[model samples]
Target: MALRMADTPTPVRHHRRSRRSRRAVLATLASVVTALVAALLAWPGAEPADAAPSTFAHPGVTVSRGQLDFTREKVNAGAQPWKGAHDQMMGSKYASLSRTPKPRAVVECGSYSDPNYGCTDEREDAIAAYTTALAWYITRDDRYAKKSIELMDAWSGTIKDHTNSNAPLQTGWAGSSWPRAAEIIKHTYTGTWGNSGRFATMLRNVYLPEIINGSNSNGNWELSMMEAAIGISVFIEDKGSYDKAMAKFRTRTAAYVYLASDGELPKTVPSQNLDTRAKIVKYWQGQGTFTTGLTQETCRDFTHTGYGLSAISHVAETSRIQGEDLYKTDVGERLRQGLGFQARYELGEAPPGSLCGGSVHRGLGPVTEVGYNALHSRLGHAMSNTQKLTEKNRPAGSNNLFVAWETLTHADNPS
Candidate 1:
């Protein structure tokens, strides 16, 4: 479903319990369990050789530190007062906007309303929760942990009664918020739920189950897969959860790939028209440009095709990590072929006006210059050891691909 943009008034009362008692319980439990689990998990015999030393510390710890320092500095810098009459009228909404709600299962949308919009998702709340929890994990700051636990409690509570199949019952409508929670839980508590068990139970019992059981249309499946993929990564430390998650992931991934290729996206876009085709073309061009412009003939003008690439990327990465031979399957081959399309298009080798009813656009300048920098950066670094590529030549966009070619030329090497 499309996100409805509106400036909704904040609700004064939420269903979550007060933070005091919740924090005391979660804090005590987290302290004891985290220490024991950390010792067990990081014991010399438990870890693989390549595990990052800090991975043993906790998930999202560094990100939390960065966010907290940034937020604290922002707050200390000063708060600006409203300058307009309308701003005064909207007083409390502006102030309470930053407060994190307690975790709950079924979020109430109608309670918050204003002239501009009806309701909004609490993405910021989830972000705050994860960041605060992570900070607590690193610094053992009771305030941060308490705040995080409060947010988690609110989220869990909201989602408990959510049964909506047409829309996400929680904020960040897609799988966004839950992943952050999972990261916080994994890192802060060393993979054990401790006081966070209620939050984990909410995710496992409510949020994730709904997403998994939902339809495959509108990239919902892919979004679900992303959540599952990240969730699997975070929880892989827990063998039982990891195994069950992997099985679910395999099923979901297969379904997502199938629906994406068999024409599910065109149905999902708001209007099935030429504009939709253009958007699809731009999206594919963006993907191709990111991959150095390798062409895939089969994917020309496939609507919302980037969703498929994203799904494939998640699956491939997960499979690689699990030491599965992804190349053995037809699905794997198709994914590789799609990646080729992305590469060829990025390199300006894809035939001009060949797709989208001869209206598809080309040139990496538009797609890669602004959109594909991070993608190129990650791929370029990952491929460096296997391929004779240098960081300077592998900048963040299509220009980097050009630099790479120039480097290869000067070195008398063909890329």
Candidate 2:
């Protein structure tokens, strides 16, 4: 029973009109935004960020708890390669009980380790920590665990920063291993690590800042840095660093390894600003011809190339443990081709004069196991050249940087 006006009020009609106009404007704005997003996505050299996991997995940097369990089970059974690999590691100086931690206040290095101050000690200590961590798991000896903790604690307490030209790369190399040892001891060891929090702080303050920024010196540098970043992120449970590092890893992985599908000139990291053909060629170590599996440093040397490849595998393995399974993505494809290409030449296949001017370096080192195990054993990919090279270097030992005892941890490991 409301009184009806002869005509609608002027303000009410105006309000209705304004609402309709606002909705129309909103609709138009949404359409424009959608079109812009589509354009951005389709732009050339657009590197989209990969998705991050809702929750991270523990003891999952390059190696997992399941992998540890499986490897230990095999070792106990006196398995052929596993037993041999374990024996080799147990016999090494790294697994020795008398090992001492050589932490540095400020590690410094120049090009090609010219300065080499605290470089060797830092790398060796990190490797020793990881080696002992593995030994502790397989042998069930409390001494190994305590020694690992001791090594980590020494570095964590003393390492304040890394300095000089190779600081970032050096930090990256050592950073990659610290988390591996930290992850195992933090999660698996029955005894307590009193200074575990301090170790995490050292990684965050000293190591993470140096490597997480993604270097442009060389693909290997950034690759190794990202390896450290990813592993450290998992150990400290920092999701943001993990995502940032993962994005860089994906970008660097693509740019580091060349594929025929990536077009005439290899994919370039945008920040590197590799605009012209000449500049790109120089950055690629003067290799003009492009082919599948050729790395940015393939012409520079196989040793550096192996570092990039190893970092790729380590990041991919860690990502897999976190539940993303990057191996099923383009990461796996690039790794497969990269490994095979290097392996083919590494296995004594002569490169034509066109390839690296016919003089390719040998010695790929203990870098193939992690990648091989994931692609071949886990994914059932047929990689003959990689397979041969990997088998020839069974029980792959440390590269004296970050890669250590992968043959013991990952040989035919199905977990």
Candidate 3:
């Protein structure tokens, strides 16, 4: 007979059953794995969806698109405060189209001792480029965009390196502006920036590497370098560089700006080997009075102190744009205290003789807007001294080193 009652063959039947069992097991395993993966992805500690984005988040870096848009809207409607600030910037020589570009192969700047040729020129050009870019963004004028592009292109096309004692500082100054201009233009303007790639390459090769490692000369040097590194990291969407720069920035800021809660001495970078109190005190310019808002460079001069403060503000602002709210952290507190303390002196209050030997070299510069806006406007903190100074210096301009046109960009900025 062809078929039997017990079915075909015992071995064949067993084999078919075994195959079906295997298939069922495999399916069950796959389902379990999928559920586990989904759970993991939903976990709080899961990896960020985009640790780094290509274009950076809108209003990314230091100034966000929202902030820019607000400025534009206010200026267009002829609002009181922003309109006046914008008018001041446009009237300034920084926004002038007649500005010239001076590019060099190697920029060498000594420590206020011997500044090489093209050092000042390159820094000013970079600032002018940023100023023009801001003008373009606010007014939607093609000429401003074109001029900004021209200035950036000139530097990218010609400059290859930075050298000398002031190289890092010079690089920090020029480096600070380059990425700001590039970020605004590359993201906002529709015009052709054919050399954008070259510009990116310039930042990556020439600027990022120089400042990414940071400096040990002074608080300002390292702070400014960190500012450059942070800005460039945002432009290039370098998550690694961004994290590294931010870590360094936090450490340096803690050390640079002091608070009474920090215990007996200011926080010190372990890499700097400032473990001993003697070394720390000396590094702090022989100032034993560790009060709130006293900076490491306070004994040196308010000008240098302003540099450190400016970098702190810039980094904090950029961090906020990138989605981290550092303004409420110890960083922000230190900044607020520092600004207020310095503002008191700048507002004509006589610094105590015990402080900085009563010879506080004062010239706080245009460094208050960013911190003032963050601490006062955003957080609703009572920053009486800072508010006074910031309002007094309406339309704050550039320090010609790194800071520029902060009043126009950050004055009462809700964003």
Candidate 4:
């Protein structure tokens, strides 16, 4: 994956008006009649006789095929241990974990802390493929495209054998896996790259139905529902599917949200919490680190259903996309509050020994510290009110370089 570019101050475009000219205009427009005349004068070219389709277009930048190919190679090689275990499990061809009796989902929680544990579930495999494919799409690299196709094929086949329908298992492993897969599929379709339609068909026809039907009654029902929503959203790509999935996600997410007593997430953050936060922070770390350092499993929490900052962020973003001003909603306000707590805790700005007070983990301090700064800057760019946040979290030195680069590349890009 391409890393985020270094920041180079983008030249500011300024329009200057003389103070005297402004005063003269104000004086001239003091009267009601004058003001009306001024409004008419300033009005953009009188409404067109017949409004025409907008001709506005965005500039297209060329993608780097070499970079994409290199990144795909690294992901494939690096994910080998996880892939090997997945393959071994699939080779057994057990109908379900209940039948074959694989390791419990909780066993893999340690994987979040240990790099060697490897990820379980078909979703991670699909995500690895999806990211590779995205890189290929952007770069137009045949190597990446080929590898992506291969990975997808393998994942699809493995998943098909595990579930009788499309629904996933309730195991903690599947909790992480399904969402990652769904996100990958969603991005692939939106990006207009690869066999997104065919991929969706496979998921809907084979993977999802089984997982959903099987796990529907379990406590993991919400997890399955959440992933299903994401997958259905990608597959249907219509208002109906979008509405249905959105409704379902909202309904199921209530449980987790309710777990937040008085709208505050518990402070005894689990290992999963750290892992999820680490990846969420890494997302803004820039493209290079994102492509090389973060994996699909690592980033799953950002898009999944759970009681974490990542989940809250996803809900906020999803609501915004749906044209709902989440900032005005109770959940949105709660998320803001939670993020405020995180910021205070991470920065050592909170009261000593307070619930929201804790030292940043040594392993994650560097990346998250930089991430906090970048995230605040991006947020500040969108809302002037967040300027203080940007300043408060601003990273120093080399870390600042990534934030600058991201600003140049994505300054005008909206979430």
Q: How high is each candidate's TM-score?
A: 0.43, 0.92, 0.86, 0.42
Candidate whose TM-score is highest: 2
Comparing 2 and 4 on TM-score, the stronger one: 2
Report lDDT per candidate.
Answer: 0.38, 0.89, 0.85, 0.33
Off by over 4 Å in 4: 1-123, 161-198, 206-228, 238-244, 251-307, 322-328, 348-412
Please, what are the lDDT tens digits per residue for candidate 3 over residues 273-331?
88789999899999988999999999988999999999999988998888777898888
Total clashing residue pairs per candidate?
A: 37, 0, 3, 24
In order of TM-score, best first, we have: 2, 3, 1, 4
User: Model 2: what TM-score?
Assistant: 0.92
For 1-415, candidate 2 gives per-residue lDDT tens digits of: 2322233335665897767766776787777778877775554433345445677788989999999999899999999788988998888888889987777898998987879889999999999999999989988999999999999999999988899999999999999999999999999999999999999999999999999998999899999999999899898888889888987888788899988988999988878899999999999999999999999999999999999999999999999999888889878999999999999999988999989999998988899999999999999999999999999988787778888888888989899
Better of 2 and 3 by TM-score: 2
Q: Which 10 successive residues of model 2 have the least lDDT summed?
A: 1-10
Candidate 3 stretches greater than 4 Å from native: 1-55
lDDT of 4 by residue, 1-415 (tens): 2234333333333223344445555565566566566664333211111111122111100112232233334345645322332233223322122221122112222322232222333434433443344444444555545555555544444443332222233222333233333343343333433554565565565545443422223222443444444334433343444444444444333322322342222111121232343543333221112211121222222222122333333434433433444444444444444344333333434333322122222111112221222234334323222233334433211121010111111112223
Candidate 3 global TM-score: 0.86
lDDT by residue for model 1 over 275-334, one digit each (tens)? 454554443343222122222222343323443444444444334334443334533544
Candidate 2: segments with Cα more than 4 A from true spot: 1-50
Question: How should the candidates be ordered by lDDT, best one leading?
Answer: 2, 3, 1, 4
Question: lDDT of candidate 3?
Answer: 0.85
